[model samples]
Target chain A: MSQFLDFIPKIPVADSVEDAMDLLTDTFAGFFDVIKKSGKFSMEFVTDFLVMIPPVLFILIIAAIAFFATKRKFGLAIFSIVGLLFIYNQGLWEELMNTITLVLFSSVIAVIIGIPLGILMSKSKVAETIIQPLLDFMQTMPGFVYLIPAVAFFGIGVVPGVFASIIFALPPVVRFTNLGIRQVPKELVEAADSYGSTGWQKLYKVELPIARPTIMAGVNQTVLLSLSMVVIASMIGAPGLGRNVLSALQQAKVGNGFVAGISLVILAIIVDRLTQSFNKKRQ
Target chain B: MEKIKIENVSKIFGRHINQALKLVEQNKSKTEILKQTGATIGVYNANFTVNEGEIFVIMGLSGSGKSTLVRLLNRLIEPTSGNIYIDGENISKMNKKQLINVRREKMSMVFQNFGLFPHRTVLANTEFGLEIRGISKEERRLKAEKALNNAGLLPYKDQLPGQLSGGMQQRVGLARALANDPDILLMDEAFSALDPLIRKDMQDELLDLQQKVRKTIIFITHDLNEALRIGDRIALMKDGEIIQIGTGEEILTNPANDYVRTFLEDVDRSKVLTVENAMIRPISLNIDIDGPKVALQRMREEEVSVLLAVNKLREFKGYITADDALEASKKGENSVINYVRTDMPIVPPEMYIQDVLGIISDSKTPLAVVQEEKLVGVLIRGVVIEALSSSDENEGVTENVSIS
Candidate 1:
């Protein structure tokens, strides 16, 4: 039976993609180098600046901001304080800060790229039709598959880790922002149109405000997706709890992995809760 | 006199507009055009003039192209072919920037769903049109505040649309349109989504506002009663073409075809029709010259118990009853004024039949349909009965009106 099936073809799809990517990178080496330099500087500034701060002072600052945002609901501010203290007690403060920086920068960059793409998508059916399927593929593809392209494009480092996270996390914001604009009530759009609102005026005055809730939801989703890429990003030399978790797994240190993993969960909850609360407050 | 004139206007909602337009020009049926070119006819060769300061209503069932027609007037939905002239300028020929200018300065629309910005306060919503026109913040606020006050929504100026009731939100919509101070106000089923009671109030409010603003309004509605209640003239559409354009009374008295006749069948005539619709030519007895005996004879000949007495100038003096005239003749009074009773029931020709019901029921003598103190017509009990009965028999009346 094995001999009968021996003639089946095994296509080297991965090898072909790799070869094409290398040639593509070589052809655009100058562009890639510029990106590499920017990526390095940004990644270093964010992670180093965050890591240099004492964990207690950073945690207090966050708690105070949370206190102001959630003035009536002090429980949220208290929760942040307690959550950070727990992570700090576990002596993974630097790792926690590093992870926060990576997640924050990845989210910020994704939002910056995603919002314009979303607006573009909303403006043109051509853009929407082209980008939607690409977004679906980006969202559904395994996180591990993202690192290959990131590593090929930027090589291995925190920059590549950040790039992979951005690639993995971008789709929700784009899709959601497009959806948000599309979902604006036709009557409101008609009202705007009837008033002779110019394109930019219509977007800023009506479409953006109406689409705010949905866009915020998209941003929240992007943040969560970025967090989910943490451990996979660790494989590309992103320093954070993800790195500790990966090393813990390699060394079979289950207790160490649990502590690092819990800290990541803490950060994720903070972001998720803060954004959700902000959305509610806005409403 | 014409605020807006839609001439040979047509819209086909599909990509095959050129072919669809050719088919439209060929006068193909809407369904045939749709099948041939894959374009749904939004409006086809719609021709009508909305007079300045008149509430021109476009009424049809959903998908009857009423909404599409209003949208075309503002170029919100561009027509496939033909011209729309606003104040003698062809809007169809205008470029985008010119059209935008037209929208900004000449026209504003109120949507059915009260298109108030959810994130904006009522004041902000009102200021939207003014802001788009690049008005100063201070001026926009002043105008917005004035408009809001005019709409009777000043109390809710600070409230978000979500915080207000549907009626209040629609008032904000009205205020928004008003803030622009546009000469043309397009209301696309502005009150259709409202509750029955609220809809009535809004209709009345719009009427009141129209009297104040005197803006040329083109209103769209599916409700026949609403059209009849508010329209100075109404255009009834079917299959994207206006089949008839006439006054509400004209539409009812003389529908264009079976479609329009059927459309009017369910409308309550009491509210839609007026006393003039049911009034017959009144017998007038001259007050100065016609003798009491002559007045008595005229009443007997007309087989009516009373006759309206008027001066030589056709000014209504009063009415004289048969018994009063007979008494006057017995007393040898020469003029019918000797018997003319000044305290008889009189109704304006424009008074709704629903309103005349009480006067007719209360008075023994026929109610005189008076316009500016002149006896125009007389509404008898029999005429009221006949008018109402004929409204029930509406289905039989087709191609009845001689209106252009």
Candidate 2:
């Protein structure tokens, strides 16, 4: 049986994929350049802006946002202040800022692209059928696989890292948005239509507002997923707390790795709580 | 004037619409069309005209296409093939812009589930139509407030729909449609979601509102009693076809088919019947012209124990019993007025038999069904009971009894 199986023709797999990637990179070289430059500039701006705020003031600001977002609930606010202070004390503040920038860029890009696509999918069966499988592929494919295209398009840097993070984080928001819009009661849509609401009016006034909480949940997921990609993104020259963890791993310094890893956890917890509070405010 | 005229309108849902519609034209049954072409005939060849300021109710059981017919009138569900005319303008052939304009300007709909936007406050929901039409903020706000006030929901204008009860939410839905001040109001089971008591209140309020606004209303309901209570005329549908269209009294007296008869059998007849339907011509003596002997003779001739006494102008005076008339004659009274008793129950001819049941049962004298000040008819206890219980076989008995 082994001999018979071995007699089958060998498939041309690796060379074809490599050649295809090379061709795609060549075809969209200028477009990729523009995206890479814009991406790097925005990422750097956000990082610099975050770094400019003193650690104490930034912690106070986050605590204030948490305080108001939770309708003056003291627990989340105190946690934000303390958790952010602990990260600052760990001496990973600059790396935390870089990670914040990466997550911020990726999540924003994902939401801006995801929502309309989700709405499109909700509105049209053809678009839903075409995009649904694409979303499944994007979500189920290993996060590392996106880095190949990210590198091919934007090259290794913060830009490719942001690109890969966006791909990894986009599917949830899109899927949730489609689900949310579709979940709106049929009667309400009919009422809107009965009132002579245009397509855009119905979407903006009825579908979007009703779907806000669900869409917000998706956005929270996207932000967290972007944050989770920080460690993986560090492999492509993305500088963040993830890079610190990577360096500690290379040097086999357990204590150093633990500190950086804990800082990432603190940031994750703060971001998650804040987004969740924002989501709950409307609800 | 006919505000809306729908002719040969049909709506078939699902694929192979052409085949389904062809089958529909060939008079195929709904089930057959569905099995053959995989299309459900929602409404088939519905034809009707709604007059301005009339509440024309379309009634049927679930899946009977009453809802689909109403939707077709407003072009919400596009007709497979038909013409819908609103004030002589063909709606089915209108472009998107024209249709939108028609919807915004000429018609608005209230939903069974209230269909209020949960995110918006009551005021905001009420102002939706005006806001969509680009009315100025202050103007739309004023109009919306007036509509809310009319609905008795002005105080709750700032509250979200979720915070309000189902009845209040439906009131907001009504106010929202009213804010647009469209020429036509399409209410698709508007009160079907409310508790029975609240539904009664809504129905009464709608009738009161109709009196003031007088807009053409096309109401849809599964409840025959509601249709009878509020509809100026009702169109009853069955199996996607209209079985009958008539006034409540007309339909009750003359049902078009067995389905309509069965559908209406469960309806509370008291709501549909009036004293006019049960009242009989009174045997009366003119008190100004007739003597006590004449009153006694009239009672004896009519085989009644008493005679209703009326003036020369037919204005109800009272009643005179045979004993009183005999006593009056013995006492040498010239007129029956001296013996006439003014304690007889007076009911209007338009009053429902159900309402007059208590009066007739409690009073010894028959009820005087007066129109204006004139004694037109009398409602006796036996006749009212017979009218209430009259079935098809006994219907002629009641009609002949009333005529005599």
Candidate 3:
């Protein structure tokens, strides 16, 4: 066997990877053309109904809920003011709601898939070795890059947009979940084993408890990534504050773009703070 | 009961091909498999049985395979070639499910670092083992409550392990082990990580707890004194083999070899020597109220030099000497008295010559009360030496002998 291995030629690894990339680029070009020819997809129904609820009222309710959960009155005040500005300045209260729904929906789906993948990675070295590189690529790859596949598969709509968003935002959740489970103290794992814990029992009771902080960190990252994806999702005809922001940018509506950007930042802060508060409560 | 045993157990690592190549390159024999693969000889032919309810101690320095030996008994790491029999059944080759059942039903382990679930509250951590056995939540909670109460950690039930002190966390670890009502407990240096004072307290607590439970315990530690304090039988290990296996008295008195002797050489015999074993048979002594002349007359007549000083009530006060009394008589003095008080520590009859010598050196006095704290006989070293050397037929009894 040693003699055989010594005689085997070293394979040309880099050439194969470059060829694969070329193939992907050509496929994406065709995908882009089809989406541009079709009418832009819209989730306007969700927006119109969501917009009917006064933007300030919705923001107040959300901020008030957050303030109670976190016990931070300052958070409520900031969220309320940010909500008022989006309503009065950008005049796209409905668009903000549409974006929030998209972010929340994709985040929920990402968490459902990503957490289990992360946990599996933690348990299995093989899984971690395979999935880790994929996670790195997913996180670094641009959200607009995801749109090419979304457009090809789902034909340019809010469903495609949300699907794309889920893919773009999933890496953090999965990576952190894996990290959290992996970070569980070795002694704790041994203790569980000594107690005769079956594989699943060890995972659920021992691994997960220690992993809560990392999982929450993943959730926070996922939510932020989802929010950032909103603007890219707009180019695929997903209607939201992201779409309004893009339109305002294209028409040189600086004032409107600024307000939309501020609302997105506020949304990111709210999600980040809420998850952190939940983590603190758990600890 | 024969709790566990290992024979010719070797766990080798590295790729099989690599190991083979290394062995061939080194021109080593099959017996040298461990060295070729860089695999540790964790429990090399470790063969010993922990009797039922015995506080069996496995003592060794770190990396001496004491921990590995304990882990092997429970099949935590499968022996490369050996069988362990627990209560007459071969457990070494038990399937995963069987091993799990055995661990759940019969044995529990306490780790040195406590290994408490930092995320779980003290109650939950205590209840973990019971939960793994498929016990109902309510039943587990009740059992956990009882275990915690026993370990004296009930007041901190809701606190997470991170919030507890090291001692309290270890108590939770113990509680978790006890909650399963295991027949045998494996402690791998369980108290070694605590502060010295806390470690002592925990050791006392363990002894007290063991008195009630009477579960067979296999404790691993490097501390010889601790092994002497708690162990009913001890296996002192070096490398991967048991150097000696004996009762505390056996190891303390007749250490198996130079290695075992060196380990016990620094041990304080008073701490280890029991008062019962150290009691001496009192020798008759003649004394007087008026001092020197009468004491000298009795010593000369008896042909023994020294006499124990006593009061009218016949309670021992100290020792007086014939030589001193004779010198005083010549000087026309009423008394010449220099003595070790009776209240001072008596060299137990069971004490080694080394310890007796140490006591003599420290006291800076001619005589010592030899009855340990009992009202046994006073001993003089010269007389004991004379008795030992004169009786050549009892040489084995004296040389390398244990005063049991």
By summed lDDT, which 10 consecutive residues of candidate 3 chain A come out lowest?
A: A35-44
lDDT of each: 0.86, 0.89, 0.74
List runs of model 2 lying over 4 Å from the truth: A1-8, B270-387, B391-404
Ranking by DockQ: 1, 3, 2
- Pairs that collide in candidate 3 are none
| lDDT: worst 10-residue window of model 2 chain B | B395-404
lDDT of 2 by residue, B1-404 (tens): 99999898889889999998888889888889989999988888889999999999999999999888888877778889989999999999999999999999999999999999999999999999988888999999999999999888899999999999999999999999999999999999999999976997798799889989999999999988778778889899987889899987678788898888787678655655678888888998898889988887778789999888889899998898989999999999887776889999899876766678788878987889899999999888888777777655436333432321
How much DockQ does model 2 earn?
A: 0.58
Q: Which stretches of candidate 3 lie over 4 Å from their true place?
A: A1-49, A81-89, B17-31, B265-404
CA displacement after TM-score superposition, residue B145 of candidate 3 (Å) = 2.1
TM-score of each: 0.81, 0.84, 0.74
TM-score ranking, best first = 2, 1, 3
lDDT of 1 by residue, B1-404 (tens): 88899899888887888988888788788889878878888888988888899989999999899999999999888788899999999999999899999999999999999888989888999999999999999999999999888877888888888998898888888888988999999999999999977887898799888888899999999998788778888899987889999987677778899998777777766766667677889888888788988887888788988778899889988888888988889988787665678887889876778888888988877888889988899889987877767755552121111111
Native contact fraction of candidate 2? Answer: 0.68
Better of 1 and 2 by lDDT: 2
Q: For residues A25-71, could you state the per-residue lDDT of candidate 3 as single tens digits?
A: 46676765554344233345446666787766766777776777676
